[model samples]
Target: MSNETEPAPAAHGQPTLKAIADAVGVHVSTVSRALKRDPESPDASKSVRRIHRIAEQMGYRPNLMAAGLRTNRSYTIGVVMPRLTDVVIAQTCEAIEEAATAAGYQILLATPPDEVNAQLQSIQMLASRRIDGLIVSSIHLDRPDMVEEILRAGIPTIAVNRRADGKLHAVTTDDYHGGYLAGEHLVNLGHRRIGIVAGPRHASTAWDRTQGCIEAITSRGIEVDEELIVHTDFEVQGGISGAHRLLNLADPPTAIFAVNDTAAIGVAGAVRDRGLSIPRDISLVGYNDIPLVSQLPVPFTTISSPAAPMGSVALQQLLRGINEGEMSSLKLPVSLIVRASTTVPRQN
Candidate 1:
């Protein structure tokens, strides 16, 4: 034998359940039950808090990968959004996280490069993670394959703001009512010639909102000039470009309604650039009532999409599906908010 001694094998990292049990002076099974906050366990709340505190002090992290392999569940939900930069999406995501945590689930978020690919990648990643469920908040929902994939994974999936073509459950706002409200508000303000800035044609929300607005206007005997209705991306640049096209018409509309707040802001900027005073020259309305709308130089009249409630409802529905195998779609109501940007048009 050599004089040099072999180094002792490095001590393995402490297992989370074992460390929690040792710190709490309880059996590993009790630690597991306590950490799960099982209702059947006696004094589970107190035991859970005690175990959680000890686990934190010991720098213990649960081996989710190994647990997922064993149980076929990660106790996590996959949340996908078109873009985290969008204020409405970000707020909804925050609410989703809170709701998931309250239900003892963690969230894994994915923002895809584009709306179409985001849906595909998010579903695939979540399936690979063995997630308990998924919540999709992106705008693209025309693909039937997305629904088939989710069903193939054999996990619950809920769509928000976009409805899939198949039997998949969905949670969305009443887009038609939102559009009708916008149209009625403009009509009541004595606007006869109204223009619309709609989102992408493929988005169901855009189609429904446009239909509602057209119906409301036509029912009141107001003519909807086909040329005044423009469909574009739900972004500021789209608003700017659509507004330019509308204003260039032989007889421009007295009021313009944008499908979202970002586009409305763009319309407002474009109108100002042309030295036109809002309501006096052109009235503007927007949807989704994002926080930024209220803080603008002229507060925008908008339809509140109830994003937080939608998120909470979606999570609650997902949990139900996870525990009871129930799946159902839900449509939350929308409310119109009158603000400074809309007014009676001034006669030339």
Candidate 2:
């Protein structure tokens, strides 16, 4: 009404698809097809690149939620872990999240403290959020009740880090072979009296590693004394207690194998507390070579489970189940990493 220059129609701060189309000299449909990466669009590849470049320059971000309304999908996956405090799971989940974002999906994370009932509640809650699939990074061993809940919910799921008994899909390391490698390494170092710090007795990891170690030891005509093996939580305190007990035995072991890195660190602490030195008094080996293990004062010899590849493969399986009704269990290989922590025993 006044001489105020008509306000320039109040510059729209948010860029829209139409703005991108007009800027790139294309129709809105062509802009959309370019944004969606639809190959069949009449828009040429160079035009698509130009549209994308302009969209970025204009600060245009796609509304995934709004697109989801038309697509009937949340384009989100739920990732479940026992605890993010655990380095192995945290790093692997980082890889999964990165890969998922690159593949145009979002991730919702949950940690239920490794309790089956709590996990069931978590699954139900994530399902209510309409997550497209779930990646359970930790599973309680042999919990049929939990497995039943997951199946009944009708959600696509892939187990990571651990696996079920062919009941559901999983992507995990070759734990059996990993344990065998640890055993063969120690046994080949001329260690006969070996102690085991096996993680939770009920878990498949503990069972399979135990069996594989036993097999490898026996293959060399060495009898594994049942009294030398101990099952405990995969924590520092648990490993300390187990290691202390083994060291106090009538025929103390010359080498100890812990099924987890945390426990292995604890065993190392136990050795030092007793005024003993590694490789001279005792040798130690760990599984799942978490980064911190290598940085320890006495770096642990360990099995390098492919954490990144495991996460990638798990997501791949989940996507396949979501898109093609196909999911299969997968086992990736692991290799042993030798370091200062393991060597030939003094007596040998």
lDDT of each: 0.81, 0.84
Scored against the true structure, residue 272 in model 2 reaches a CA lDDT of: 93
Tell how far residue 224 is off in model 1, in angstroms: 1.3
- The C-alpha local distance difference test score for the whole of candidate 1 amounts to 0.81
User: What are the clashing pairs of model 2?
Assistant: none
lDDT of 1 by residue, 17-65 (tens): 7655765678999877665552322344766766665664566555666
Flag regions of model 2 displaced more than 4 Å: 1-61
* Best model number under lDDT: 2
lDDT of 2 by residue, 1-348 (tens): 644221111146757777777776779998987786522223338777666667767776667888789878798999888868878788779888877775568999988878788888888889999999999876767677777778898989988988877788889989999999999999999999989998886677777777778788989999999888999888899899999999999899999999989989889999999999986899999999998989988888999988888887788778778766888898999999999999888963
Q: In candidate 1, which residue pairs get closer than 3 Å at backbone N, Cα or C atoms, i.e. clash?
A: none
